[model samples]
Target chain A: MEVAVSIITGLMILGALYAIHAKDLLSSVIACGIVGYSLVICFLLLKAPDLAIVQIVVDTITLIIMVAVVLDSSREELFLKPDTQGYVTTLTGVFLLAIFLYFFVISVQSLDILGKGSLRMAEQYINGAAQKTGSANLVTGVVFDFRGYDTMGEAVVLVTAVLGVLTILRIKGKK
Target chain B: MKGMTLIVKKTTQLMAGIVFMYGIYVIVHGHLTPGGGFAGGVIIAGSLILVTLAFGSDFLKLVKEEAGTTLIESFATLMFILIAVSGFFFGTRIFFNNFLPKGVVGHLISAGVLPLYNIFVGTEVAASIFIIFLSLIIFKEESAQ
Candidate 1:
């Protein structure tokens, strides 16, 4: 299972690279969807169902939005061409991936990224949450409690994105 | 567009509605399940996009952008702030701490301000994402033309 999962991840990384180099924006968006789905599977295999669901849902929305944006902005070109420096980019990417995988392998051996309290002041929520707030999901408890302010800031970011889109698209006396 | 035929569109449209309802279930039962505000909320927005793709902007007209989107956005924000501020009265430093009342762990009324915050987050995320998609779809179509 691990080998299969790793192979799938490798394919996904290749797809992502190809998408970045592909001249077609729509195809790139499709590749992004593939990457997103693969990541969802990876998260599921890692025993993080919550993160998996979030990734799938958020990625679906983002993919659709991006495709729509690109479709609006760009016309279909007659020919498709890969980047001229694709070999260089691929080598650089592979180098980075190897470095990342090395660090990830070592860290997974020694540390727990999934372990709670990875962030500063995270222990405050992990330790004090259930007793004080009585929430079941530790992540939910941390997000809405210890890091409530941060989540609020995230919400503001979403709101601001909406506002920005509206401002950019607004027309005089249209509404 | 190439692979998505007419039958696929019709089927996906129905699936979107199901997904939307499922998202609401996840949001409401967030405390009990693995899902919560953010996950469920985005699922709801995903369903909206499906509907948009299948039926186009006319279906969205039923919601009326101002009342459905903007109003929900503002109201959700207000509720969140109120819950946070009420924590101050109980002497907690930040939001939703003291203001929330305690109940059974698995019960609907439980989780103090946690569940309430989930609801607010669910609404805020759902409305904002839907609004963003709507504006983009509308504007992009115009620009393309």
Candidate 2:
């Protein structure tokens, strides 16, 4: 499982890099889709089927929208020659990434080993969750019951996003 | 934009129904399964997108969906809020309190209020996403003209 996770992560990085560098907008969008779909695989491998389901469908819809937009417009992105500023920006980005990676490794080492995470906070949720929520699926119980307010907030956020999109897309003055 | 071919259209006709039903199943069985409203809602939107892509969407049709989507999304959110707030009128007068009887653990009606939340949230999410897609399409059409 670890090996598969690592391999899929590698594939995701590859897809992301290609998406950033690809000249054709359509192919770039497809490469971005590859990254999202691989993330779905990662979610499933990590035993989060709920997230995987959302990721796959959301990724597909996002890909369709991106491809539609790209196809409607010009497919070819303007190619710019690598200048000194561009090289400096790339170096700064790589440096920032290395710093993040260093901290990530440190954090991983300081954490509990895999499969033995401390359930100090989740103990109650894990023990009496089935009886308290009266739901077979604990995740949904926690999401809808124990954390119902948070769920409502999430729904409100989604609604606000849609409203923002519609408002922004509306015509200026007349109808 | 036009559809691909006859074969694609025929395949979509058979498959979109299955996808739509699967999304409903996910939302209905949310308390008993790994999927819930949000995932199911996105899946439902996906089915709609598949149909729109395969058969092609019309300008007038999108306008209707746009209006209905906003209304349905608002309605679902209102229902969800009402259900949550209605808890104040029920046992313990607590917000989002489980006032309904929790059936058998594994049964469809097991969860007190989770299923209702899932159903309402499912509709809200589906309509929101569908409207976003519709708006994008309509924008494209208007821009093209």
Winning model by DockQ = 2
- What are the per-residue Cα lDDT tens digits for candidate 1 across A59-83? 8778877876787678454574558
The C-alpha lDDT values of all candidates are 0.77, 0.89
Off by over 4 Å in 1: A1-5, A69-128, A171-175, B1-17, B58-63, B91-93, B141-145
- Fnat of each candidate: 0.57, 0.84
DockQ of each: 0.54, 0.80
Please identify model 2 stretches exceeding 4 Å from their true place.
Answer: A172-174, B58-60
Q: Tens digit of lDDT per residue, candidate 1, span B1-145?
A: 1224578677986697789889998888776678889899998888876766776654446336644788898789888878888887785575556466667666777777788888898999999888877766655445555
User: What digit string (tens of lDDT, one per residue) describes model 2 on residues B5-89?
Assistant: 8999899989999999999999999999899999999999989888877877642376777788889999999999999999899
Per-model TM against the reference: 0.78, 0.93
iRMSD, model 2, in Å: 1.0
TM-score of chain A of each: 0.67, 0.91
> For candidate 2, lDDT tens digit of each residue in A42-141?
9988899999999988988888888878977899999999999999999999999999999999888878865566578788788888899899988999
